[model samples]
Target: MHPENTNFIYVNREMRTLSNIDYDITLLDWLRTNLKLKGTKEGCAEGDCGACSVLVHDGSNSEVRPINSCLVRVGQVVGKGVITVEGIGNEKKPHPLQTSFIKENASQCGYCTPGFIISGISLLNSNKDVDENSINDSVSGNLCRCTGYSPIVKALKSVGNNHEEIKPIQFVEQNNDVQLGLVSYHNPINLDELLNLTNKPNFRYLAGGTDLNLQRPIINEDQNTIINLSNIKELKNIEVQNNKLLLGSAVTIENFLVTIKDRIPELIELLQRFGSPQIRNQGTIGGNLCTSSPIGDIAPVFLALNAKLNIFGSNGRKKVNLNEFYTGYRKNILTKDEIVSSIEVPLPKKDYNLFCWKLSKRYDQDISTISLTVYIKIRDQIIDDIHLAAGGIAETPKYLDNLCKDMKGQKLDKSISLAINNIKNYIKPISDIRGTADYRIESFRGLFRRLEKCLVDGVKTMSIMDYNNE
Candidate 1:
């Protein structure tokens, strides 16, 4: 058992909150076991399934975002407001999304119904003008073995089309009575307090809990005290400075999409494919980088855009290029006492051409088999400068620096063919379930050909059929 003191919050709601909890139990378990909110199912213990979706509000003026409770630690929701499906509506009056689902016969076997309803409601509440494709992409992580997607899609579209002025459910504010389960945990309101927390040993920094919660259980259990950075106001900001865009570590993918969708449309597509609505709403850009998965959907985009990360610790702040951040497969240069405070991406120039593509067997809710991102600038029909990166081809998301160097100053036709050939030589791709080394290599060549055509034709066109089944 763990010792409880000023760190733990005494939950006063209708549930019994545990104190000094050992054994990293998830927020989903806390809801079902302690809170008796069994309406939220545990379809998958991992974060992949959206069955345990919930809305986590920081008690600030910012909008609420959906999260997967299965991976969230029970202690992480201390000061924040957690809204489960039970909190949304009662038997007498259902939530608009819930009502629409029933009317459209969206629930078959009813296992994934609550999750779909919660995700749909979150998306619609966030944006009333949600399109059908967005709706489909938002709920992609939710799986109904019964194959009742048509009605679910119908229900979501109906809510967006018909319910334009639906007011969101208001929960009682409990900021004054905020209680947490742990003592050493710090929920800093400012940057100074957040930086102070980093001075301690055995500190686990948390933002969105998309990646941390899953890997937290096996880390350091003895001195493992988590520093919840979600409440830091400075780290939740998004602003443009000079010619660069800075995104705070706590800025959710859903929020970032709204800010830069028009400016970087290709990035918007990548964000849509990052994860499901619940994951995107909860996952932080910092968390994505820290995960350091070779197949991370966001890393390639950051590489192509030449982004920089601002990391803060006891020693103060430091910056690192996104390309150099990843040291190896599932490895990073982050220190235990350090936290990624923000990410800076430069605005593309007029002549800059950017493209990103993810090759996966399934379009939605599947990891990238081989992802590639290219940023090229051409002058006088000669390749002036080019940045190329590929994921799932090596241990780390590596920039094809040597290959790009080989192709630079050459014509697009011969240079691209040489670049493709060089990639086959330089990259040591491994055969995984998603694809083989040969397949990934060939796919990269094909992508190079298509990208070269786009550059030559001077047409920024994307195949609608690429994202559509029909």
Candidate 2:
């Protein structure tokens, strides 16, 4: 599939290839060993740490964004463009943030400087105005054992007013398919070609590598075949029809946030804590749902919205209700040959008000202890209709139909108290690294308390600081 000169990537705007390398090699390894660019360090191979952060252009029409090089395989970027720390700037002609870092004493251990610089420069080059919040979010994936992050924030602020133009990057022609070692990677540009390939057996769909790549058994193992869904334009569409919002499976979470900013301003705060900027830029909503993780953040909101999933396969296309999609822990109703094509979210009516909240140990880049979404319509100060859904409180994302039924026709305060007292009836969560089963129950109840206070008392900061006081 090299096609004489095509099975290579434009690394740092320079063509680079490893014709004999295996597909199991990570981009971090390839950058350090094969290409001999050791600037991009690898701290956490699981993509938690940003030591391996790099800017990547997917060879699509979009510009470059940050992602973890450790979680990405070389085969996945055959025709894309990658820019390591070295590509951004150097000591002689350093980026503005680089110089400011030294002046602010942002480099003590220096293990994370390159990654921080890379992430900071990406923010500086974007159309967004630089601020403390933006700078903090941009480098949230990075970890510094020293410097305490104070100098880092100050350094980034020093260059916040400066914006520079990045040189154009080049992309190599994409190989339709390639087989290396135990991994067979396929890049299909359209829906028909994708379906034709998945009609066979033992194939896995890859939208974003954020989740799958962390689990080594899921990628390049047991001679597995990967059908990459990112290149298909049909799976990346966003549309509105008949008072419903249609979101394609391959659309990144960052793009989803941008699209819904004006329409659903309520979700903006909850999603800002979705993940680090790198993850939000690469992880997709369909990928989030497909994993069936009990704590996956996006599914609860969809469940509350009465969303429907659009499925396409050899049998043709069909729509399935989101609440009925999950069967059990890490399980769904989709057949092996079928994949989620898109998600349809019904737009709220004039009388309906939606509220969503995520409870995590840390506010950003953390897994939820419990996630809650409440959609309510009030008529004459009585709750006419309400829908409640939550994550991390059960084996699957639980839709609280019984509780919704119980709370209807009740006042807001009465409804909240009744539901908070009855949450344990609907969920039986397991103890895990994030929290205990008992703690999760209380957290979800606390979210209901928060809903009551915010709506009735005009609480500030969403009452996050006074959580236990309730």
Candidate 3:
């Protein structure tokens, strides 16, 4: 079983770091109970509610992302810095976002204000000129029972209008003197050390902790050892080399969106619909892919794009296609000691046409009932090559290999009919809360038809603007 006592390292306002006593508790409990930082409220003990949102800087310190403190273990914050609501400003001086929120009457019950204000500040830090859509996406995770969304939106807009210059705040140094519950584990700065430590049998590799945090109690008491990758600097890099985009495992969905927005604008729309703003900020692409959820938004897109995954373990490094990464339902090809290091996606050719669509109950914050990703290469009205993938239709995200084989070199009309026929014969989706079996089947056919029409009309159906407005 995991150790009961872990260490806690906290950085203060003056850039002074301090250690806490007793590490058995969670960061949320520590903040509220010990530190008395009541500004960070606990709407839900789980990560679902944004009321506990706080900004945390990864090892790189290039940008900050919002994370839910409730799900984070106190032991995980060692060596890194955390910015809670209290850190935003003091009573003598308030942050522009805070002032705007109050002036706009954004706070109703005031329970969720701190979280929303912190999220708003993070958004402003990332982008000085915030649009309405960005404001909406940033606060989607914060739930206000009073439903006073308009005023909050107005408050954010007011801050953007003023365009105040906000200085960056540095976290205090780590204090090793004070102990918190258990001795905290400082994240390894070197990749070699990280890999060696992670090769141990029971060590759990954690990135965003969106999923793992849900089972924190079980993981804490179980035989699993924890190794947080969030503090590893090497794993947060993003680079483009030889027409392929390489994303480090620690890169969050928020950073990914910023990196690719200019090059692949269509992806921005798809990403905005992924989850609430809080989820996007804390969830990493590596963790999302590793989860191997059939309906995961990034799975089919990766498959359609022919992405590659780089993995590391004691045995050394290996590379494989993202499509072949999954073996079964909720299962992957990764060994116990192996952790994904990075993902590489090849850029599409100039003439290549790609499209993606998701059928869900709600436009945002809903799992896909059926998701489809299509990529096609056409030459003079003839199909050169085609790749298609779907989730929520089978145990795993599957590529239509047989369909591609039959449709290659065929005309668009023939290919469309063959694709529709193949989907009916191949896909075996189960009935679930989001969709019925028949509904999913028919939706697949309709999506295929729409893709064909888009190709024939010479129009691009997917747009970043579409998702921004959603």
Instruction: Return the top candidate by lDDT.
Output: 2
Better structure of 2 and 3 per lDDT: 2
Candidate 3 C-alpha error for residue 85, in Å: 2.3
Q: Please give each candidate's TM-score.
A: 0.88, 0.94, 0.88
Q: Clash number for model 1?
A: 8
At residue 85, candidate 1 shows an lDDT of 79
RMSD of each: 4.0, 2.4, 4.2
lDDT for position 169 in model 1: 35
Per-model tally of clashing residue pairs: 8, 0, 24
Q: Looking at model 2, which ten-residue stretch has the lowest summed lDDT?
A: 458-467
User: Which candidate order results from sorting by TM-score in descending order?
Assistant: 2, 1, 3
**lDDT against the true structure, each candidate:** 0.75, 0.83, 0.75
Q: Write the per-residue lDDT of candidate 2 for residues 1-470, one digit (tens) a residue.
A: 23574577878888776577765778898899888899999897877789999888865444778888888777777788888888887868977777898899999988888889888877887877788778887888888887788889998888886755555464446755766678888898889998789765678888888888878553355777888888888999999899888999999898899888877777777777888878888799899999999888899999999999999888899999999999999999998878899999988776677887888888778888888888888776688999999898888998889899999999987888887888777778889989999998887777787787666654423525355565
Better of 1 and 2 by TM-score: 2
Candidate with better TM-score, 2 vs 3: 2
Candidate 3 lDDT, tens digit per residue, 1-470? 11223233433333323344434466777678877778899988776668998877633354666778876766666545677888887678888888887788888788988899878887887754688888888887778878479999988887784644434344432312223333234366547878667645556677777787786563243344567677566788999999988999889898888887876665777788887767777789999998888888888988988999999877889999987899998899998878889999887767888787887877777788989888889888789988888889888888877777888899988888987877777788999888899999899887878877778888665543443354
- Candidate 1 residue pairs that clash: 7-182, 7-183, 8-180, 8-181, 8-182, 9-179, 9-180, 9-181
Candidate 1 TM-score, C-alpha based: 0.88
